[model samples]
Target: MKSTSTLLAPEEEFPTALSELPVLEIHVLHSRVCRQLDHEYLTDPAGAHPVTLDRHHELVAELDDRDAA
Candidate 1:
């Protein structure tokens, strides 16, 4: 598949591609990692941006729930 990143202008994006191994499952695996981190590690971790962390956790939860259904 052509990379969607190429649709962006050169200056607006960096080079990236879906790696060969398990490209189809990357989203599921990545979400599991984020959910683990959100629940187990990132709560008020020192020197981090609290607002950004909160937003990330919210997104992770939403995705996880959608996938679980």
Candidate 2:
């Protein structure tokens, strides 16, 4: 009879595909900031401009989620 130990050998854990994901672009981040600024300017020509770190974080989170999926 074949030994059960051979059948129970653990499989190797290969590197995740996400390890190959490319880094985010600085230019793209700048462009997104510029677009947000433009929209703010259009909406309120005299209002104090709000810098959106949250927007950047959301963008990064979305990219990471895509990579994981």
Candidate 3:
């Protein structure tokens, strides 16, 4: 049998320093629940944890906060 890895096309990279992140649009670190179940079943189980929809927002908050400090 052969394996197939073509699900989504490759994404373009935007290289930027950490200090240039944006402000947050939402608050609270999620409910800290069931987040893993959907990922475990829906995505590549062996692959690294998939980034959530709001990951960029969260990262922006983190980076922007560090810059402010």
Task: Give candidate 1's error at residue 53 in angstroms.
Answer: 0.5
lDDT for each candidate structure: 0.41, 0.43, 0.36
Query: Residue 53 in model 2: shift from native, Å?
Result: 10
For residues 1-69, write the lDDT of model 3, one tens digit per residue.
111321211132222343443333122222121243244447765743444433444545665576688
Q: Using TM-score as the measure, what is the rank order of every candidate, best first?
A: 2, 1, 3
Q: Whole-model lDDT, candidate 2?
A: 0.43
Q: Can you give the TM-score per candidate against the true fold?
A: 0.33, 0.35, 0.28
TM-score of 2: 0.35
Clashing residue pairs found in predicted model 2: none
Minimal lDDT window, size 10, model 2:
6-15
Choose the strongest candidate by lDDT.
2
lDDT of 1 by residue, 1-69 (tens): 233331222123221332432434445434443554454445545633444355345545555665686
* Model 3 CA deviation exceeding 4 Å by range: 1-10, 24-41, 49-68
- Report the number of backbone clashes for model 1: 0
